[model samples]
Target: MEEIRKIIHIDMDAFFASVEQLDRPELRNKPIAVGGDGDRGVVAAASYEARKFGVRSAMSSKIAKKRCPQLIFVRGRHDRYKEVSKQIMNIFHEFTDLVEPLSIDEAFLDVTHNKKNLPSATLIAKEIKKRIKEVTGLTASAGISVNKFLAKIASDVNKPDGLFAIPPKDVEAFIEDLQIDKFYGVGKVTADKMHKLGIFKGKDLKKKSLLELSRLFGKHGAYYYNISRGIDERSVNPNRIRKSVGTEHTYQSDLIDTKEIKKDIQKTTQSLVRRLEKSDFKGRTITLKLKYSNFEQETRSRTLLQIIQGEEMIQKLAEDLLDQEELKTSIRLIGLTISNRINESEPMQLTIDF
Candidate 1:
């Protein structure tokens, strides 16, 4: 018999916003956002107080302000965030070396073979949470289960300084009652498609055969089929390298003028550059994405001979990519991505469903 893998997922509560609040005591208990406040600005993170007003990450500053008139905007300090992340990750290592970071504020840790020789994953999760609060003065939520999929979902059950665990004996019943939308990979689009096909929840999804789901959702159908039955075989990998760092913005109004489009491109490129510098990522390929007002999307990519890191160089490349094609219609969105990283030659890792 295959032994169940004891996995734990840890996620900080509104990490960026929480950090801002932690550093600035005056911002505590107040609705705050960490991102730009200008017209082109997007919310990088929103406090729980802000979230009560339906504010969310990636929402336009304009809409977020409209939603929460009293929302406070603060610029993100990625350097500080990174420093805190390092502290949290080091704590995870004290318990186990099998820590796989999903982002700066969340990670998966496999404790089936932990260094501490602990028998209970739940106890470990609680201890970790306590340690994080003690060390960073911040709260984190933890989910522990038989595998990464279940663990990730369990973590969100009791969020904002909470811990939840799904044991092996209760896995089947627990999964059967889980909603399809709550499943690891089921996004809004996939959920709607599943609903149309009468697959609204795990029980509904479990009725479909592999062949049937494959025909409907392509390769992802197989994943949905297995996860619906409490099956996920992903292992925690500590050395997984990030594939790319990028950012995009959607305009409230369509941009028709070339000058306006170029300006937006420059702004987007600058944001991407900041992200690259924060992550210390270097890549040779620069890709520009454009979404037309009618929702038609196009991409242009260029690969340089050497690693590219400068803001001026990246902005120029993004603009050049924009000039390559004439606009057929007004553009509603613009994005820039840097990939084809230099010297990082590991095969792509499995997706950890957010």
Candidate 2:
């Protein structure tokens, strides 16, 4: 029998927007967003006040403004965010070396056997939350459970400044009532498919057998089957892995013509290729990302037999992917990315709190 693990997931509340408010007191208790406010600008983060009006991350600045005219926009300061992140990270290290940062503002910790030798993961989460506020003057929400998946989902239950836990005894009850969309990997696309299959909640998901799920969802079928019953055995890795390299260009105006979109993709791919060469990175997969004027985004990727990093090859693949689709929508951003190693070990699950 495997020893039951204790995991905690910590996520900063409205991270970018909160940082902006911390630096500018005038922006507190008011609506704010962080990112470019130009024609090609996208909202990287939205304050709690802004979110009340349906303003959100990845929304176009123009659309955000229309939704909330008084919304304040601030440029993101990555350096300052990094400085604060380091402080919070130090606190985690003081407790355990099993910290896995999902993003700058979020991380997972396996405290089953920590340096402090604490027996209760809930206590550690509470102390960590308190320490982060005292040191960084920012609020963070924490989730504690027996595994990484449960901890991550629990953390979001109480947003902004809250702590939630899912004990082993309550795991089944917790997951059974959880909605399908609340699952870690189930996004809008997956939720719709699950809905069609009458899998709206954890209970519904559990009704599907392993073979049926595998047939419907392919490789991810097994994942759903396990999680529906609150079983996630994945370990917490401390390594901060760099998985991919990519670049995106937001046009000043929507590129309606296929010729214009192709040109933009070519330029962006060339720049990424040069960067890849400089870093001596080798990858076999190429992904194309397109963001339409309405803020809808899509990605297409292809993996080849050999590691390829040629600009023409990347450009051609991107073009081919775009060519297969009808240009019905005007595009405001074009991007290309190359994925690196396929980790046969535990693949990282990175989540961003919206």
Candidate 3:
């Protein structure tokens, strides 16, 4: 029999907001948000207090303010956050090198054979959370399970300085009771679709045959089928490569005129170029995405013979893509992504707050 892997998923609690509160005593216990407060500003992170008023990350600053009139907006200090993230990652390294960082604030650790040789992954998770609080004055939640899928879900169960463990025996039952939306890959839209198919929870999902699911959800149906049965074969990978780099923006108002749209595309391309320069990533495929005022979305892609790195080429390609599509409505969002990397052998490993 194969040995059950000991996987632990650790997620920081309101990471950016917590970090800001840690450094700034005045912001403690107050409804604070980390991001711009301007008309087009977006919430990068929100404190627990801000969340009470329905303020959330990625929400527009205008809406966030309306939700929480007293919400305090602080500029994001990404450098500080990254510095803290490094410290947290170093702590994870001390216990095990099988650490897979999902984001700056969260990671997955395979401690089935830890350097500490501690027999219990639960104890290791406790130690990690304790050390993070001591070093960064922040709290982290942990979920210990047999695989990455269950471990990630367990981490969010209690949240904010909490920890939960699912032993091999309880994995099936726990998953059966889990809500459909709680599954890793099921987003809001997907969950609604699943509900329509009478798959409101894991148990309901399990009733469907693999073929049935595949026929409904395409390729992702297999994943849903396996996970519903508490089976995820994916192993923790430490060296994950990023496959693409891109940037996008939501305009403060819908853009209708072609000249204005082209100008914004230029600015968006410039931003994407900056990101590409920062990450030093090169790709041959350029995809242009647009979401109209009515929320309808479309994407157009072109694969070039050579890698696209220069802003002139990217902007031209993006403009060409936009020109090719008919504008049925005004555009509210524009995104430019460069994927299919020059080196296609390795895949980038990267994800969410919870």
Candidate 4:
């Protein structure tokens, strides 16, 4: 026998832009975006007004403006956002300790057993939403369901200041009518593959057997099979930790010179070093990412016997990764990330048990 879980995913609406609007009274009811107002930078968030003009997060600021000439851009204040995040997270703690933050703006909370001893998760969601608005003057949309997958998707079903819940009884029908693109873990690339396989909706996805899905999707086949039927078993874990630390730069313009590229690598390495120092995280694997002029992306990584430390080793490996590959076109972006972090204090685990 198994127990059903009560999960709620809370996502702030256009967090960065909303913060901007909240702090600046004059900006309300106006189109605004938050990010670099430059040719190469990407939009981090778009106001509801900006969205009407087809502006969106991750769209280049240049194009975002082209979509809406009046789109006002503001630089992001991460510190201020983090401060507000702390306030809301405090509110979440008032309900349940099993709160797992997905990002700065989204989180999953397991309130099947909460501090308030609430009998209803929907009521809890409503209370949380009201409390957040009263405390931070920002709006958050919430989705309540039996599990993380459904709850996460449900959060987006409604827009800003919205609440949606999928009860156990309604889960199946709700999932069946859901479109394929709305399924968890399906992005543009995976959606294209699914569309080609004639899976345009949840019902279509359910038609495929696990064996067929596995053959097509490899390791994630079982995930799709389960999620398609409104089945997900992931628990809300509050103690999740970061696996990697990275920094990236979408260049102001494409870089054609190897010398200039190396300089950029050194600059990125310097920044990474500071972050690594701040977190005291050392990773054995260094991954280098590049985006060519055509927006084709490539990533290459190297693992070393020794944990990577200091700016010198970081720069050396970054340069080595670049040397291993020949640029097919002018590079538009570059990034450096490190993983395989060494947990010096954690005891080693046995490979087998008798």
Quick one: best TM-score, which candidate? 1
Tens-place lDDT digits, model 1, residues 1-354: 988789999999999899999999999999999888888677888999999999987687899999999999998887899899999999999999999988788999999988888899999998999999999999999999999999999999998898999999999989889988998878766788789888877888999999999998888988988998888888899999988888887786899898998887766776786567556588888898889999899999998767777667987888889889898899988889999887646554444558
lDDT of 4 by residue, 42-131 (tens): 677899999999998767788999999999999877778878888999999999999998777789999999999999999999999999
Q: How big is the positional error of residue 57 in model 3, measured in Å on the Cα after superposition?
A: 0.7
Tens digits of per-residue lDDT for model 3, 1-354: 988899999999999899999999999999999877988566778999999999987677899999999999998776788799999999999999999887778899999999999999999999999999999999999999999999999999997789999999999899999999999978776888899888888999999999999999889989998999998988889998768887777887899898999988876876676466434477889999999999898989998766887767998999899899578889988999999887636553432348
Error of 4 at 263 (Å): 17
Residue pairs in candidate 4 whose N, alpha carbon or C atoms collide under 3 angstroms: none
Error of 1 at 218 (Å): 1.5
Model 2 clash count equals 0
lDDT per residue for candidate 2 within 1-354, as digits (tens), equals: 978899999999998899889989999999999877876566778999999999987677899999999999997777788788889999999899999987788899999998988899999999999999999899999999999899999999989798999999999999999999999988776898899989999999999999999999889999999999998888899986767878787777788899878877766765676455433356778888889999899988888765666766787888998897786699888888888654435454555669
- For model 1 the TM-score comes to 0.80
Query: Where in model 4 is the C-alpha error above 4 Å?
Result: 245-285, 289-299, 302-320, 326-354
By summed lDDT, which 10 consecutive residues of candidate 1 come out lowest?
344-353
Deviation of model 3 at 237, angstroms: 0.6
How does each model score on TM-score?
0.80, 0.75, 0.78, 0.77
Residue 244 in candidate 3, Cα distance off native in Å: 2.2
Backbone N/Cα/C clashes per model: 0, 0, 2, 0
In candidate 2 the C-alpha lDDT for residue 156 amounts to: 95
What's model 2's overall lDDT?
A: 0.86
Q: Provide the overall lDDT of each model, using Cα atoms, as 2-decimal numbers.
A: 0.88, 0.86, 0.88, 0.88
| TM-score of candidate 4 to 2 decimals | 0.77
Residue 27 in model 1: lDDT: 100
